[model samples]
Target: MYECYLTFRSITPCQQAQRYLTGQSLRSQLLRTPKSIAFKGCGYSLKLNDTAIGLAAAKLRQANISYGSAYRIYSDGRVEELYL
Candidate 1:
């Protein structure tokens, strides 16, 4: 399975983005942003399958919901930043 993490500046937009993605038929999980890449301080993140990454990001943009950054979680436990 592939996983992606999308960080948000705050909890509000993070929750909004998760709800928006759910409405669009993409499944996501709300979780605390990884400490290593948390925005400014600690924050929230939407964890979803890699297959939904592009669509999720696009939909979030279309809905005007802002997010900070994205990262891909490797099976081997490495986390790399994503440009989406």
Candidate 2:
């Protein structure tokens, strides 16, 4: 299955997003942002299944949590940047 990495500007928002997503019953993993995809500088990210991207995005929006860019990691190792 593909995975989606949702990047955040800072660790604060990243942690808030993880907590909010957990409250909404969505599964996410908090991890250091991959060097290749980290925004601006070092950061963190929420890793979840690609299937949950839409609902997760909606939930985050409803909670007023802002995030940076998102990237979809393909099974074959290709990474595509998402504009959402």
Candidate 3:
């Protein structure tokens, strides 16, 4: 399964990440699609549609947000970074 992990460059006081997220948080807009052979992250990973990754990245950038990277795992069990 292909997984997208998003980690902040410098996450401070880990607890801050929790306080920042509350009722109806901004992350609520993020959605995951299982039909695309993707897996949702445990905590911070934002599961997005592979085809829409670019659009999502753009929106994130416009919102002053950043993501770690994108991973593509092939049927042969080879995983690599892919462009959006």
Best by TM-score: 1
Residues 1-84, candidate 3: write the lDDT tens digits.
564433333334122332333221434123232223334332244444455455655555555555555555555666666565
User: How do the residues 20-39 of candidate 2 rate in per-residue lDDT, one tens digit apiece?
Assistant: 99998999999998876764
TM-score, prediction 1: 0.87
TM-score of each: 0.87, 0.86, 0.45
In every candidate, how many clashes are there? 0, 0, 0
Any idea what lDDT model 3 has?
0.43
- What are the Cα lDDT values of the candidates? 0.86, 0.86, 0.43
Residue-level lDDT for 61 in candidate 3: 58
1 or 3, greater by lDDT = 1
Tens digits of lDDT, candidate 1, 1-84: 446999998889999999989999999999988776774897899988888887899899999988888898776777789887
Per-residue lDDT for 79 in model 2? 80
- Candidate 3 clash pair list: none
lDDT of 2 at 84: 61
**Model 2 Cα shift for residue 74 (angstroms):** 3.1
What is residue 7's positional error in candidate 3, in angstroms? 4.9
Candidate 2 segments whose C-alpha is farther than 4 A from its true place: 75-77
